[model samples]
Target: MSAALDQTGSAGHWSPVESWSRDELESYQLERLREQLGRLARSPGHYGDLFGRMGFEPEEIRELSDITALPFTHKADYVASVAAAPPHGRFVSVPMSEVRRIHFSSGTTAKPTPQFWTQRDLDRWADLYARTAHAQGVEPGDVFQCLFTYTWFVGGLGATLGYQRAGATCIPAGSQDTARQISTIFEYGTTVLCGTPSFIVHLGEEIEKRGLSPATSKVRAIMVGGEPGASVPATRKRIQDLWDARCYDFYGCLEFQPIAGECEAQSGPHIAEDFVCAEIVDPDTKAPVPDGTPGVLVVTHLDKQAGPLVRWWTGDIVVRDRSRCGCGRTHARLVGGVHGRADDMLIVRGVNVFPSAVEDVVRAIPGLGDEYQIVVDRSVRDDATGFLKGIRLRVEGSDPALPARLAEAIKQRLSIRAEIELLPPGSLERTTHKAKRLVRADD
Candidate 1:
């Protein structure tokens, strides 16, 4: 059966729920939230203990707003629970027998947080991914080459199943040799390329070195996530120019398999309202903020059966728009993708700076390479305040005049002067997975 037929069986969306009104979606969410809370309350695990300590009951959750009364679940909490419990941790709601798979976080900042998925959880994950894929225009006969790693990371396996479920042929080409991967793109007539934006940019450069034009390749769409590049205007334009295809953002993390995704309209990623109830709260106060306000994102699984997360603090900074999208999705849209991770924010001379903001400035300049790094040199600390003395930007660009232009651009955009250092192309290290942008010189 064709993907279109399957998606349209019940309604115009992949599932009938995607087109639901705000009231319908909220009503469904309330029902599922109660069930999830009830399950967590009944489980002899961490959540039950937490609820008992707070004198909170599942029945007390009369409405979604009441969820605010519960304490937020942080990554540290899961790590601590894993340390206390042996295998799956005390946060899991289901038995080990029902768990069909285990995936871990990238562990870039901390140890990999173990995630368990039962058969039902895996099915829901794939179904939600299928919905996202369909919305992003994945269909039968489209060959999707997944460049995400397949080891323990959730991105690779989830994307493979989701695209396949959307009726696309998937090649699980985990991040390995870029040359071989590029060869496979042509060999298999791959119609879609999936991976981090950095890898795609690197692939495009490699294609140029091989005397081939990426724009002329069979790939018609580039589905990117796991980092913040595709949503940035200059970065998005670069990828689109390199591949001559539409660049769609697939936003999710290990904790949430398929949170939100961009439709064909490409306005922004629409949250999976029926799958997860998303909340944006002040990072400091932890109070829910109004829609369209930038704050830390908190996610709760609505129907997850295994390790269900209730108010999992994502720590990702984003703005939520609850208005209907041009594509008719009533689900909230994450404006401009994730602004930046709350922890990733840098304080430079009393000015708040996000690497993405610098990236926007650097990538906008002509003749600059795709790779760049931000350095926080602790050696140059202020004697009086004991704070950062200066910031430096290391970039790959041959033009001597590039540094001056970049410095001015950074100062104008960020309101802080940045020491710009220009290096020859290929000086900076490249990666196939998530790219690290910030580095402390002291480390």
Candidate 2:
């Protein structure tokens, strides 16, 4: 069968769940989930041991509600397992010969985790990506220009395949040269742009410097991922105003190829529960949080074959809403997108500050654009006298007064004064995708 047909088959049918009734889609997910657990339990090694330790067979989880009994798989478990078994770990359901593609994790916290995909897994991931593209208003004949990095990472590849499978022309721009990327957008008359939020902002700045109007360009929509800023209202508004195009937020990782994506409604992103089951749990207790509460995100891939992930902890914080969404999808929705990562928290003088919090304040400042970084350093004084330790804000902008205003705003909002330094135009390095914002000078 062709890739499209294979994907449709894997999804059990292509009828848009967005149109289906809540109860109907719930039934469908429960039915498919039972089958997934059965297939996973039959696999050997770690999964077998896991099922045995749980004291119940996969068949016991026939209903979706029964999932509560299954033990959540944390990232630490996977890290330790991969360390014990080098390269590809024993979590893989299939042999090495069957795997076709490999994508490495971001490794922002530690060593990069490798995820392998079979042809079938790729097809399923592509289908979900296509659903996301379609929901974002991408048409069959539209031309897509991908600006995301494709090097050993799945973001660009998955997007390219998705546009292809959606019957659209895809240009593999591959996150190189900003000048060339802007030139290509005009030359090809591309309608869709995909990349990290920072790269899109950088491209917009370059476009402005070159006397190019994004509104005049053929771009109509920008699909952004690989970072949390895409969903921030202030950041999203800035990018939309710069490009004059609709900005859609997409969230995913190497472990789970298609986690969630925004629809044209531009509300919260719909979790692709058909392929991956998502759960929000208390960071310390490993217990599920109530709807509309913030907690860490945990995921399990339903159709992943090469390296099947079951209840894998993402370590990212999110707010999950079980209530029915306006988009009509029965799947859960992640409100406000990813809040921040648990590991990214900085505790200074008893107050915990997340980069996202700083981002909210920085991006909301009227004069400052979305280009800024937060630097954290330990105090040199032997005795801790003051409440403030060492938090500095490095802002990149041409305007002189923008940095000071941003500093005042941060102080008012955070109740902690931050030393703000305004850098010369283009002083801070710009990344092609997923800009690194936080730097720990203490280490």
Cα TM-score per model? 0.96, 0.90
lDDT, candidate 2, equals 0.79
Model 2: which ten-residue window has the lowest total lDDT? 6-15
Please, what are the lDDT tens digits per residue for candidate 1 over residues 188-295? 899998899999999999999999999888988988999987778889899999999999887998888889998888888889988898989998888888987889
* True-structure lDDT of candidate 1: 0.87
Query: Which candidate achieves the best TM-score against the true structure?
Result: 1
**In model 1, which regions exceed 4 Å deviation?**
1-11, 379-381, 388-390
For 1-443, candidate 2 gives per-residue lDDT tens digits of 23345334233223356455667767877777777777777877578678877776877876676787877777777777789888877677788999999888778778998888899989888888888887777777799999888887778999999878776799999998878888888998999999999999888888888887887888889988888766788788888888899999899987888899887778778898777777788988988889888889988777678887777888999988867666555677888888778877766656667787788888887766567888866552125563446478888777888867887887788776678888876778888978888876666
TM-score for candidate 2, residues paired by index: 0.90
lDDT score for residue 51 of model 1: 85
